[model samples]
Target: MQEFIPHRKCVGCMSIKPKKELLRIVRTDKGIFIDSKQKMPGRGAYICKDLECLKLAMKKKGLEKSLKVNISKDFYEKLEEFLKKLAVKSFDAEVWE
Candidate 1:
C-alpha cells in the first residue's frame, strides 16, 4: 500500500502542497512561534518557503486571519529574517526529509 502523505494549504499563495514542503507557524497561548518541527501545539497555519509567498501573506493578512491574531510589524520582520537564514541554510544541505 502506498503511504498517505499529508497536505496543507499555503496561506500566502493559497496553494495546496505537501505538508513537508511548507513551513508551519503556530499561535499558542504563550505567543506566536515558527513551528519548524510541525509539532507545536495550538492554532497552526502553513506557508510556502519562498520569500514571495511570505510577502503575499503579509500583504493579504493571510496568516493573521488563519491564526485569528493581529500580527505585529516587528514579528513580520523577525519572520523575514528567519526565512532568509532558512533560505541560505537550505541551499547548503537538504535538511528536511
Candidate 2:
C-alpha cells in the first residue's frame, strides 16, 4: 500500500497543515456538522483546534467563502455551543464530529 500523508487547509488561517494537526468541520446531506474523526462523507474544511481559529474563520466569513454556501448566525451559535460543551483545551487535539 502506498503511504499517505494527507494535508488540509485551515479555514481560519488558510494555512496548510497535516491532516492530524487540524480539525475537520463538514456539511453533509443531513445537516451542518463537525467531523471530529475526519472520516465522514461530506464537504469538509480543516481548522485549527483552537477557538481563536474558529473566531477568525467566522470574522473573515471564511467558512461561507470556502464552502460556497450561506451560513447563518444560528450555525455559528451552534458551533460555539458545541465547542463550549467540549471544553476544548488550548492545545488539545480534536476532531469536530
Structure candidate 2, residue pairs in collision: 34-97, 35-97, 36-95, 36-96, 36-97
- Reference-based lDDT, residue 86, model 2: 60
lDDT of each: 0.87, 0.77
In the range 1-97, model 1's lDDT, one tens digit per residue, is 9999999999999999999899898999988888878987999999988889999999999999999999999878877877787878554223432
What ranges in model 1 sit over 4 Å off? Answer: 90-97
TM-score of each: 0.89, 0.76
Task: Give the per-residue Cα lDDT of candidate 1 at 66.
Answer: 99
Task: Give the local distance difference test score of model 1.
Answer: 0.87
lDDT (tens digit, per residue) of candidate 2 on 1-97: 9989999888898889999778777888877677777778988877786678889999998888877778888878877766676664563335333
Specify the highest-lDDT model's number: 1
Look at candidate 1 and tell me the lDDT of residue 61: 99
Can you tell me which runs of candidate 2 are displaced by over 4 Å? 1-3, 84-97
